[model samples]
Target: MIEFSNISKSYGSVQAVEHINLKVEKGELFGLIGPDGAGKTTLIRMLTTLLLADEGNVLFSGKDVVKDYLYVRNNVGYMPGTFSLYQDLSVEENLNFFATAFGTTVKANYHLIEPIYVQLEPFKKRRAGALSGGMKQKLALCCALIHKPEILVLDEPTTGVDAVSRKEFWEMLQGLKAEGLTIFVSTPYMDEATMCDRIALIQDGHILDTDTPTGIVAKFNYTLLALTGKYKQETIELLRSMEQVKNAFPFGDSIHITLRNGYSVKEIEGLLQKNSVAYEKLEPAKPVIEDCFMDLMTSH
Candidate 1:
């Protein structure tokens, strides 16, 4: 439903995005996964017709985003990263306002947003700013879906919400996807990437890898060791100093170490013992999206 061909964007000397070629098929839930300043917002803005690219074309449903911007705007539902609703407006008022602005009525498209709006029904008269973070999130989503657009573009929708709310938000998205809504969502959370049908791992304004969650993990071609014990900081420093160690960084309570070819796990253990760097567990670790992302980032 969306395609970015050789897309590049810049602000002065800094390139926010570069040579980004991506495709989000119709009815597919595509994720743009990256950390802050990785250009996810810039890319989304360009796709949503809110910003123009420095080079290349952005097409939405086969229409040029530059020339056919009006159509794109009407056909795409956008929920920006921040809470952009009017603070003084009541929850129902916000939804009605958006629906009216789009030349539609709340009742006309109620079915499209019913699942999400139902959760906010009890607070229909509550002022938007007075609502909790999770409640505000639901209100924004309802407003976005008020028009029943062809695609939904969410930019870091779960950034500041609580864990339970984040989980609920993804569940809502899955329900939307099941209803055949083409969804293009960006997030800084690696765990959220797994929920998408496919994802593009981006960093430093460049795409590192784009694949299904499992596909991306399968491409991690290295021996990963998870080491957990005392002197965690010392163990990381020691691992980085070794010529055979390609990358070593903290992962949760353990330190994930990737080694170069010809480096054995036993050799690492022996070296740690030789240096008296005590460790309780040091074993091969399974690769995850974050691990793959870090590897791609450091390798570049």
Candidate 2:
């Protein structure tokens, strides 16, 4: 339902987004994965009609976003990274306010936000500032969905929330996707990238890669080995110094190491033994989305 063609946006001399061409299929949950300052917010703003692109064009349902901004705004629900709700406004009041601004009423669309609103009902009379981080997030989501817009555009919806809240929020999004809502969400968390139908890995104001999370992981063209020993730090240093190692990074208790071209698992085991690294566990592991992302970034 959304299409961006070579879209480029700049702030004076600084280019926040460069030549971004992307498409979000109808009823698909698409994710943008990147770190901070990766142009995710800028791209989302352009798509939501909050910012104009300097080059190329953005189309929402075939309508130019710059030219048909009001129409696009009416059809899309946007929740920025920050909590933009009024601090003094009660939960119900904020919901009503947003709905009214869109020429709708909370009562008219209660069913649409019932799942999210149920969590906020107890705090309906409480001011938004009084709610916890998770509760505030739910309240903001309720306000965003109160109007029942056709498309949902959320920018880093789970940035600073707790782990449990983050999990709950994603589950809620999955529920929305089942209802056929087109979702375009951005997040810096690589783990969340796997939750989307498809994800675009963005970096340095450019798209590194875009594909299904599983597909991207499958494309990782290296045999990954994880090593854990008493001296983890020393092991990482040793692996990095090895001529047969291409990329070595510490992942939790194990060090994920990539072998250089023309190297075999037997060769790696021999090398580790020759170095006297005293490793206790060594095993081959599959590449995850983050691993693929790191490989892509380093290659670029």
The TM-score leader among the candidates is 1
Reference-based lDDT, each prediction:
0.93, 0.90
**RMSD of each candidate relative to the true structure:** 1.1, 1.8
**lDDT string, candidate 2, 201-299, tens digits:** 999889999899999998888888888776557778878888888888877777888876788778878888898778777888888888888788878
Task: Please give the range of 10 consecutive residues that has the lowest summed lDDT in model 2.
Answer: 227-236
Clashes of 1: 0
lDDT of 2: 0.90
* Residue 281 displacement in candidate 1 (angstroms): 1.0
**Model 1 residue 75 distance off true place after TM-score fit, in angstroms:** 0.8
Q: Note the residue pairs that clash in candidate 2.
A: none
Candidate 1's displacement at residue 131, Å, is 1.4
